[model samples]
Target: MDDEVTTPDGLRLAVVQRGDRSGPTVVAVHGYPDDRHVWDGVADVLAGSGHHVVTYDVRGHGRSDSPPGRAGYDLELLAADLRAVCDAVSPDRPVHLLAHDWGGCQAWHAVTGDALAGRVASLTSISGPCLDHVGLFLRRRSPRDLPAVLRQALHSWYTLAFRLPVLPELLWRSGTLPGALVRRERVPRPSTRDGLRGLELYRRNMARGLGRPEPRHTGVPVQVLVPLRDAYVTPALAVSATTFADDVAVRYLPGGHWVVRQRPELVARCVAEHVAAAEGDPGTEAPALRRARARGAALAAEGGRAGPASRWSGALAVVTGAGSGIGRATAQELADRGARVVVVDLDPAGAAETAGAIARRHGRHRAVAEILDVADDAAVAALATRVATEHGVPDLVVNNAGIAVAGPFADTGADEWRRIVDVNLWGVVHGCRHFGELMRSHGEGGHLVNVASAAAYLPSRVLPAYSTTKAAVLMLSECLRAELADDGIGVTALCPGFVNTPITTHARFAGADDAEQETRRRAAAAAYTRRGYSPERVARRLLRAVEKNLPLAPVTAEAHAGLLASRLSPTLTRALARVEPR
Candidate 1:
């Protein structure tokens, strides 16, 4: 349906509505130099999903009636126009807002001021920052934030050009401006009239709004989509909404300013998810939204930073082999950093112990224990499904389950080799295959950490079976990293040297009698203890590896040294493999 919405200032705005009228209303507003057509792609998706999606041109754009002068483009009047449209479309209920660029700016003004008070349920702002928020961000600048501010200034060089007297208008009239936009932003050819009149937005509002920004706050749940590749707005500025809104979630997308046109389905999906979450729908709480709430509460208490309390705050993590050693320590470490951890292990008692410790330290909901043998592909797949259904998709998965088999290649039988490979190598494969699929399907990026060993790169005759399995895991991580890069999933292989853990005591020794096996276990365990590297240290490195998205992380001095030696002199490493340690 097409209609004319009259603003309080007596201007007729061009409006179009789609989908069933009885459904929840979603008012999508377009940016500068673009008409309601910019939202055609997004509207089609939202309307098909059973939303009453509305798109409209502002006062002086498209088929809308233009006011006499620049004063008509004031933010206050634009906000009033938005309010009038919302009242005309859905008077009885609060409507969700989808806005981009200048439209986002006006929507922010409406939600913050009394223009649309109690009328907006939520707002999704794309590639736009509230000028007041930007002003305050600049006013409260610290030395550390200067680099980000400078980067934003560089991105916003065109705003200065827009403020020029006649150049922008001349360019718009000459076909050069539309050509530049279509070539650079990959947007459809914009109407020249809309392009010419929208320049008033920059000239009329920019200086006044930014020079003296008011304190703007809103109770509406706001989702800011910060396009990392946007030429007009930097992520730092786009996320400044967190400082103003009571409920704000910032999602960093891998696209440019016109992402709505480029990836309409993805943008529409995000919008629907945010709207559903605002409507209190079950299972609609994404990890980013949860983190935003947690951060908002924390900021309310401390009046501190605007971002997450910790990088892992409100993140969901799955750590396998959490019965003890590196896995247990990693679960605890992630819990300490504010991540909810699912502690998985083959031993039920160990998993419970780790969960209990985490619950006592953080809270009861921070940990869940599951018993699963990672080598079993079906079991791993089942666990992945349960975790996603119950706790949402995990942001991090650590494949740390493994068994050690130290023996000469000649003495190691097929059964022994199979056992070690299944536990050490296939365990990682199972975790990655199942959880990685979940992450990809969820459309949210995550990280996978596969724990290999220094034995992966260090050739050792006594540890031939163990070395082969670890080497396979290392190569698998590298290959998976390359494969999943486009899907926004990161893969890491953690190689640690002799950490003081229980693996040595449980390792199988081929061709050894029971007494001799016991003696070898005792000797290996003691040697590892003497080396004195702790699993906690390895756990810390694991966190760093995830944060940095490192492809290969070598933990402990000997691990680093072994990796360096393997690269520098394969001859020397092979020669050392011939000697048996006493």
Candidate 2:
């Protein structure tokens, strides 16, 4: 239904409503110089999800009539306009609110003040900050927070220009500015009248709101979406609003200021999750939403704490073979860096135990476990799907699951060859193919680590089958590294020479009977133990490789030597490989 709403100031505002009226009402407010049509992509998604979606042009923009003077565009009147929209759409019940840019500024004022405090159920703000909050943020500046303030000041250069008298209107009406906005900012072609009139928003509110800040507080559950790559609004400015709101959650998405247009489905899903949680439907809510509510409740319960930020604070990672040894150590290492971990293994018990340990060490919900056989393509695809649903796309993925088959190639049975290839070679393939797709679709840069071995480059006559599988993994990683580079996804092949892990204990010895196999396994395990390397040490190198986006990372001393010798002194290395180890 398309209708008109008269604000308190007697301004005729255009309102467009869609979806079932009986469903949860969601009112979306557009930013400066942007009409309600900017939300067309997002509104369709929310409507399809069974929410009653509403989008209205702010006064002085779109089909809405502009008020007479600059004072009419103040936060007070803008807040009133928002209140009127809410009253007309869902007068009986509170409506969920979503806003971007200047609309977010006014919505914040409305929710924090008495304008529509109790009338708004939940709030989701994207690429916008409360003007009063920004003032307070700039005022209480510590040495550490100064850099963020300065960075934000740089991103807001246009705001300062917008405040100028004649030049602002001249640029908006000249027809050159709109073309420049499209070419430079990638913004959709804006209406000339909308741009000319919307300038009053900044002129009327910028100095007044920030010049004298207020103690704005709210009980509403607020979700702040920060666009990481926004040109006009820095993430720091958007997330700083969390300091003012008691019950607030902050989420980071990979996009520019016009993220809704680029990733509408993601934005819609996030809004739906927030609305569902507000309605007490926790079944479909994301883990992040649940955690956010719990955190906000805790902050309100027991005053907030000031803690330094960590690299892994908001990051998510998935580690295969995390049940034991190198995989377990890697998962723990990533968690220590502040990342939430998804611990996966072929063994259910091992995966659960590892996940439990991580959860206990960090927070109970920081780590999750999943039982998966990487060799099963369908199973791995399902795991990828589940992880994306439960948690957002993983920032780091470690394909570390592998097995060992030792002895002469001729003596190795066909079944043993197949088993080793399936677990080691095909498993890496499955993880890369499935998880890689998730990372690409996310549009955010991520890293993939494939655990190869020094044996990949080191020729071994006795360990032919094992070496072959490792070598294949190395090549696959190299190929993926080149292919996924443009997508901002990095691929690294980790080659650790010989670490003290349980692989030796489970390794099968070909040409030997069962009893002899047991004897050989023990001997091999002893030799690896004598090498005195730790899985933890190898794990550190793996993290470093991801941090630097290294294509080939050789972990141990022997690994480095093996890689160099294989390239420089191939004849000598091959001669040494021909001699069987005792």
TM-score of each: 0.91, 0.81
| RMSD each, Å | 2.8, 4.7
What overall lDDT, based on C-alpha atoms, would model 1 receive against the true structure?
A: 0.87
Compose the digit string of candidate 2's lDDT tens values, residues 163-237.
999998888788888988899768789999999889999999999888999868788889987777789877666
Candidate 1 lDDT over 1-582, as tens digits, reads: 889999888899999999988888999999988888989999999999989999998888888999899999999999999999999999999999999999999999899999998899999999867888877766656876777778878888888899999899899889998999999988888988888889999999999878998878899998887676789888667766676888777665656899889778878888888888898863567655675456445444433233335357678899999999999999999999888999999999999999999999999999999999888999999999999888888889999999998778899999998888898999999999999999877655789999999999999989999999999999999999999886678999999889999999898999898999999999999999999999999999999888788999999999999899999999999999999987
Which 10 consecutive residues of model 2 have the lowest summed lDDT?
A: 302-311
* Angstrom error at residue 164, model 1: 3.4
Residue 161's lDDT within candidate 2 is 97
Clashes per model (N, Cα, C within 3 A): 0, 1
Off by over 4 Å in 2: 138-143, 281-284, 291-317, 333-342, 347-349, 352-371, 382-396, 404-420, 436-448, 453-498, 506-533, 537-582
Give the Cα error of residue 111 in candidate 1, in Å: 1.0
